[model samples]
Target: DQEGRIVFSNPASHRIWDGVGIEELGQYRGWRAETGEPIAPDQWPAVRAVRHGETTLNQLVRIQGSDGSEKTLLNSALPIRRADGEILGAIVLNQDVTEREASDAALRQSQEDLQHSRQLDAVGQLAGGIAHDFNNLLTGVLSYCDLLLQELGPGDPLRSDIEQIRHAGKRAAMLTRQLLAFSRRQILQPKVLSLNSVVEGLEPMLRRLLGTGVSLAVELDPALAPVMADPGQLEQVMVNLVVNARDAMPQGGQVTISTANRELDIAQAGGIPAGAYAVLTVRDTGVGMPPSTRARVFEPFFTTKEPGKGTGLGLSSVYGIVEQSGGRITVESAPGEGATFTIYLRRHAGPEGAQAKKEQRKVLPLGTETILLVEDETAVRNSARRLLERHGYTVLEARHGMDALRLLEESGRNVDLVLTDVVMPEMDGRELVQRLRAERPEHKVIYMSGYTEQAITSGGVLPPRTAFLEKPFTVDQLMRLVREVLDE
Candidate 1:
């Protein structure tokens, strides 16, 4: 027994070893748990304990049973000595801790995922704030350019320069829209419509964008249900998905777009409520994403593309649009196995509706109504005043809400409309509107801001029926909106 041989094994040990005796265990095969190398007989904890009078504790090891089954063991061994310190035999203990180790690993991964999600949210908020302020500045620049272009004749040398300035401003405005989308603050006009129809209309454009190297396939279920979503934003989501799929398949592969109606149970729906959904999937047969990249695919400003090739906001915008529309998006991928993006929008039970009609350009209407414009930004305020004055409206400008209120009081509620920013110091547009309505119950108000309606008033400061304007508006937009509000 002192020669590192087991003299007796407990019934528990025998059961764990599949009824094998100590002799069979001595010949059993095993490996180091941390490294898959064979465990030498002399290097075993039990052997070391007896031969060298050493004590080994919590040495993780992998063992193979007589039936060729494997198990992970946390092993410990201690030398058994006589009263005179003479070497006797050794005692060993082993515990199956495989499940506990796996549980710990899962907890760590969840923590890491939560941390990443928080970081992404922080970045998105910062981007949204910057974009809001930038939109205000762009509004001033673009509005002034519009006024300049109107004053200039066709043959004027500076007309082209002003046009270029307008073009740049529009591009910047698009970028700001992307930022707002990623922040989940973009205003959406959701309607109940068939998702299949939206996909059908975009097939031609998608094919052309994917080019000849890639084959496009659309598998739309005719019975797919209608979903409540903004058609334009959904189109953007599809375009972004297709573009990403195309980029993934540089050497040429098939891109498939499919839609179906699904009924999800609580277990299947994840965060969303169990309900019927219109499910859309875009899949590619090209290089896919690794786990690390897939984990951060929807994070803003995170991109794997070369510099200047991507802005890294495509997937983020898609994420925002889906979330804002009360839908959910998920991606599945493995390296070299391609990728698939699945979007689920709640099925609308209401009556199906057609896409909202786009406003048609018509004769620009002029107004003689006295309007009070309150804005914190000087440039934006001046630009609005100039635009209104050129449209034959009496423009009364104030730097903020309180100043506007004072002006309104002095004017004895003679102003026809109060156009004010939703966010301002001293008093916000919401409070100012309350004061104005108290004075003149029939007064009209239009809440305007560079920030998204959701960001400015998540508490419902602006009612659903309130007239609101997004900043960076063209002169035509301003005039038309003002005329519309004044007429109403």
Candidate 2:
């Protein structure tokens, strides 16, 4: 009678364990009645509590009971104590939480799946809209820069200023290209490139950009293998990182860039593929990112800086480019401890070195050959006219596609090129191109836009090799693209 067991189990546990009576509980202590099998002693909470002289809870075990059915149980046990602190025995409690656990696991998995899907969808939509608008802006900047360069005299007082304008315009264009690259919407002309060579080439420009107050250091590995990527894009990534670092420092600080050859093993790194990589690390001594900022740093339009200070696309574009290039980027930062952004790119097993040559665009001569300029924006059209005339071309101006066709019909002027805007009020650039091709196949056409190359080229928006110029372009870009189109 001293070993008698009592039955006052919770309703939940009683139904789960199949424990019916007080005597039955003691008799089936080491067994499960549902499955007519014995329980593993080591896994029994009651045994553990009694042997260890302590209580245990939430311990899981698989057991069979009287009906020969298996059930997973989450159990707890406690030693029954007397008023004099003597341990009488143990009280065992079990709950079958198999269904609950399974349901919880399934729900968690579904949520993760849903979140991933939403992120991918969001990225795609954003990439499309961003690329289109970015290309347009680049087009305008490059075109104008080109035009300005043509007007400057070699020893003119404004020559340096004009050159700087050209340089800044080019950088903006490069930024747009990065946006396109990150979106994987830009056409890539990848070549084998040594990391050391790329960094060395940018030393002068980096020095100029960082200014005299900030220190620039490069710790490139001589043994680093070549990587296959667009050199311009890679340079862009470096510049963007450097610029961000510069902005982080109010009083100026050191920006350290290092590149080394390394291999990523699947087991070693969770996300990046196993391969040889050119690990590029950019570190700064400025204020570091907080956890909240770090989490959203790679999201488009997310920035901590004041409005008008940054476009917030720099890091996001960098993230896109790295991801699109079959590489991975990771950031490390601690509040007030500065920050480091590490980029891992798959290395190409090739040549040890050669400095990448600066691409020189061979500017063609402007001729008296006529060009019909069609643009709705008054400022843009005036600039185009001034730019074309300055280049010694007989320029014809029209406000829209219809007006352009009318000028051609009325004047019967020997038109050489139809320079038109892509987006218009009545008939679009693409439509204008079609009408021209049908009516006057003799005259060549060039399309200009702030639209990304992908958007303009897709869905037969613009024909192949039918010269396209991006909006806000400098004079030189306009002339070259125009000449290139005309000569075609």
Task: Report the number of the highest-TM-score candidate.
Answer: 1
lDDT of 2 by residue, 137-213 (tens): 55555556656666677888887886787688677776665555555554333567876777898989987989977
Displacement of residue 185 (Cα, Å) in model 2 is 5.1
Please provide, for model 1 over 1-488, each residue's C-alpha lDDT reduced to its tens digit, 9 standing for 90 to 100: 47656677777666566544334456678888788899876787877777788899999888886678777789898999999987798888878876786677566766775686687678888988998899889999998998899899999999999999999999888888888888787666666888898999899999999999999999999888888888889999999999999999999999999999988775242244578899999999989999899988998888999999998999999988887788888889999999999999988888678665656568788888899999998888888898899889898889887898788678775888888887888988888888877766787878777777433454223454357787778888888878777876
Pairs of residues at least 3 apart in sequence or in different chains that clash in candidate 1? none
Give the poorly placed runs of model 2, Cα more than 4 Å off. 1-189, 207-215, 249-254, 267-271, 306-309, 324-326, 349-364, 368-386, 394-447, 453-468, 481-488
- What does the lDDT come to for candidate 1? 0.83
Each prediction's whole-model lDDT (CA):
0.83, 0.70
TM-score to native of every candidate shown = 0.76, 0.57
Please report how far candidate 1 places residue 98 from its true position, in Å. Answer: 8.8
